[model samples]
Target chain A: MTFFEIMLLLFLIACAISIFFIKRLVNAVVVFMSYSAIMAVLWLSLESPDLAITEAAVGCGITTLLFILALKKVNALKEDGEADRDEHNI
Target chain B: MSIISEEGKKTLTSFSDWVSANSPDIPAEVVYPPKKDDHGHGHDDHGHDDHGDAHCDAHEEAHEEAHEELRSSAYEALHASDAPPAAPAAVTAQPKEKETVTEEGPMTERTFVRTLGAGYRLIAAVCGVLLAIILLVTVAFLPRFGSAENPALNEVSRRYLEEGLTDTGAVNTVAGMILDYRAFDTLGESIVLFTATVTVIFLLQQSRRKNDEARALEEEDLQQGVRSLPARVVIGIAFPFAMLYGIYVVLNGHLSPGGGFSGGTILGGTLILAHLAFGEQYTQRFATITRCTGILSVALLVYMGLKSYSVLTGANGMESMVPLGTPGSIFSAGLIFPLNICVGLVVACTMFTLYSLFTKWKA
Candidate 1:
């Protein structure tokens, strides 16, 4: 198809693959950041700069902070030995 | 990993050695089962295998879950390690601290309060879910409602053009409606932002002040100021431009599509930029700006509303001195300009103030 469409398709594929295979939470977050950037690009192509900006800022900025905060809480659980010990039992 | 890079080569060799050690005589064809079912001739023969397959699938799922749990914990570890000290302390304290909120002290009273709170929470959740579902379904079935384009877009544009254009006198009818015709709504939006900022400042200010007092009593600077040279330089350069652009957006509200909201964002962005550059210390210096803007915005909104609307409902008989000069001229939009400027200032100040509150912590 068109070059723009091809790029969009590739980005979607990359996002899907990352979502499927990325295991580490931090790595997954990094992938999500890339995914957000790609989505913003897709939005730009669709002629929605406002939506793109919102996605970039809120999705990548605030959401990332929240994710990091959540991960921090999870880490605290790990340090407490609950999450790590439960993994072996699972 | 491949044989190309040093690490890749080492990993490959190690893996290969391990594989060979585990199953030296295994063939690749033997390792991988056939694509199609080869033993599907009778139920008797395949029944046991099918049961085993089901069990294997279940086991695999559990294994995957375990791996996921491990990864999640690892991610948490990394995050906690990287986080600022205050965050861990807050998080740790949350679980340990018992919430002593009571319902007027009596058992019957407490039970009633609990039930009422639960009922309200349930109702709110249900309403939220219903709204989301309705929006989703509408979006999905939007194409069935019309042919080539979104009918809602055209309908909204038409409404803005018909009922709003003359009053605001802007060529871009949508902009005019957003700024002047619905100036009160814009004002409310600005006030909402201002309120958020004030709330943040109020919440953080007390705790921070208390901490400072404690530190003073103990004779120690428990809090360390921010220090990033690159951030300082970038903020120094960007802050002026952001402020200038913010003013421009507010000033040129009538001339352009952008108004108060857009301008305010630029102003807010400047604060964010400074916070990013100089760290949290710089935010304290700009508290005056935030407070002044918060008060000024609300006062301006109230004054504008009264001055512009004689009766508020059926007819808005606001008069403007500026002539609706031409269709596309910058000076044409009557009250849209001033209204937009007010909105921009309010939104900017509020956003920055809120962000400041979020970044700062009680030492």
Candidate 2:
């Protein structure tokens, strides 16, 4: 495979491995962010820069912001921190 | 504990022997993994170690004891109950794995076939519907070649720009035509916006009814929590500037790209932003004034159209009541300035109404 293809494959592998093995929800969110960034790069390489930019903006910017907001909101609603923290890490 | 029991070893040995005898062409290693432990019997073990003997003798003793207890319970239940089935052993041993596999395998295939056939039928039905829609749309629009054109209004401003502008002094042909030539249509459009705004306000007022009912019943259910301070602050800060820009766009539309409709929309957007920043209660506070503005703007537009045209609606060649002023000046476009103002007001009101409806409905 080409160098870029090999790198993409490696990223895909990392995402899958993290999804399978990672236990905390927040850590998984972080990995999901990486996955989205890699996907945007792949899209850019495919020469669809408009779609790539939109994907990065929406996937990594707005959606991530929304997720963080929701996380904080839910965290505020419930007093328990440790249980959900580990649950999120997964 | 032994990893593989003696009985398991015997079973394995028999299974290997059975494979070797039944299909000698198959490799021995392919049929079974190499035996790690040795069994005493060298030959005839395949037939000798029967299925029952393959199970541990200790498990057999435990099964025997459990079976005895089960028999006592069955006897007691039978004496106590009114009805009993004929084949008790048939019911008891029904879960035998070999028997289960043989009976269930065909039944499962039957179910799979039935479901797959149903799925295919559903797919065919959906495809047929989509294909019909495609055919209908394609056939209907085929005659026009997909170009649906609206009828053009009479072209009056072509000569007005070349000849009349020198005397009328209106530089912007569109503004000259709208205000001087067809001020009535602009006024009508403004009125339409105003009416739309009123309708929206009326709709939003229903939220008060809801709030009243809530207070009557369960006020506790109301979400009285404060919104994010950052969101409120940002929206509040941005609101005034957006409204001012919208006004600028509407007022300077004749000079640039925007018009009354565009400006009104911007103004409406600003109001909506304000509503979003503040709570529904703030909207209710200003509801009356919004409603009045909406109604008055429409009334003013209607009055102007009627007074200027003095003819039936939708008729062409209405007389321009006001004289066109100097070219490139704000006043030069006769009725255009007033028409734009009307348009701006209508757009603003309509948007405000729509936003109000949304906020009210949400509340």
Candidate 3:
């Protein structure tokens, strides 16, 4: 593998591992988003531009937006949870 | 196996501790009550070995009122039984200790769940390791990567590379292969997208009549939408060009690397961005629920009709009438161009509908 490909693969593994350890759900989603972005780039390097574009749009864009919206719905957003905690303390 | 189980136990405990710490709904007193001097001490050591003494002390002070509430209930139960008031303290000590013991050992329903979860983790890890070993052995036996002698570079691929352009009348062999040669497969994919959209709509569609609180929340969202001037400005500038690019990619599928799926996703993303920037009212005017359903149904039907005609004609050994026009042109591919358009429309509508359903409707 090329150096660039190796670096991307290593970063992908790091992102996967860090996602399990990340305390905040939002941060985990963000890490997963970066992983998708790297995967898209990897697809391009592998000479499948069709998969690259689909991965960029579907994996990075639509999936991340859906995850954030789900987080908002469940009041799992950090700001929302912090506000709820303050109200409970009162 | 024992080492893996020990690791699993550690992970399970840490995960549970993290959940109890982060979830605001569960009260600290409910999770970690004040430990008494006798049985509580041993169980606390067993369960909360990693939890510092300072953490326990802080929870003990913070939940002092909860302690008083529990103590009063215990005292009443003891009084009714004609036991000494000091007996209430002993009875109170047993509950937390019992709870901790139940959590650590397989004793109750909660213990059953814990055991099942741990068993699941063990099985999954074992399966993963076996699959990895199998895959590695298989790979080791295969020909080297990129070797010309590899079975992947067989006559089937050679035929596609040599005659795909002439047979399908498309410069892009991938498009020729998918849309022309394997048109039925593409039809199946389009139908799958349509089915998924219908399932999501069926599951998440809200009732026609909204409650007052939901209406108020929607109004607030609209107000917030209008106030975001910078987002509106940015999306307004980016929207048309992105839509144009998506259209370009779809139209040039027979001549380029991208085809229906990528282009459709880009189109769907732009639609989502427009909805975000212009508010639901503006987007809903053009992309209503009924309109999206109509588009999806029409696209899938058209794809099915065209592919069925081609398949029937080819099977009968008759000279199919659809003219394969000159290669390297947009309209050259006999059936590929229209098929791509149909797939693109189905995918785009499905994506946009999924986004709208998720954000606007109550599940």
In model 3, what is the error at residue A3, expressed in angstroms?
1.6
* Best candidate according to lDDT: 3
Instruction: Quote the lDDT for A6 in model 1.
Output: 79
lDDT of 2 at B81: 17
Least accurate stretch of 10 residues (summed lDDT) in model 2 chain B?
A: B78-87
**Cand. 1 Cα-lDDT:** 0.52
- Residue by residue across B207-280, what tens digits does model 1's lDDT show? 55543322232121112222445766766887788679778766776665455665666666666666656655
Residue-level lDDT of model 3, residues B1-363, one tens digit each, is: 865554433333322233233333444335343234423443343332333323333333333324433433422331222222223233344456653543344335445666787788789889978998999999899998778999999999999999998889988898899998888788788888999999988877643233333334354454234445688999999999999999988889999988898888888888888877787877887887679889999989998898888889899997678888889867888888888888888888998898877776532
Error in Å for residue B150 of model 2: 15
What is the number of residue pairs that collide in model 3? 0
Candidate 1 local lDDT, residue B69: 22
Q: How do the residues A1-90 of candidate 3 rate in per-residue lDDT, one tens digit apiece?
A: 899999999999999889966766789889999999999999999888878888998899878888987876554663434333332221
Query: What are the clashing pairs of model 3?
Result: none
Clashes of each: 2, 14, 0
Off by over 4 Å in 1: A1-90, B1-140, B144-150, B153-156, B161-167, B213-226, B279-322
Model 3 accuracy (lDDT, Cα): 0.70
By summed lDDT, the worst window of 10 consecutive residues in model 1 chain B runs over: B217-226
Clashing pairs in 1: A75-B76, B260-B344
What are the chain A TM-scores for all the models, listed individually? Answer: 0.75, 0.76, 0.86
Q: What lDDT is reached at residue A24 by model 1?
A: 55
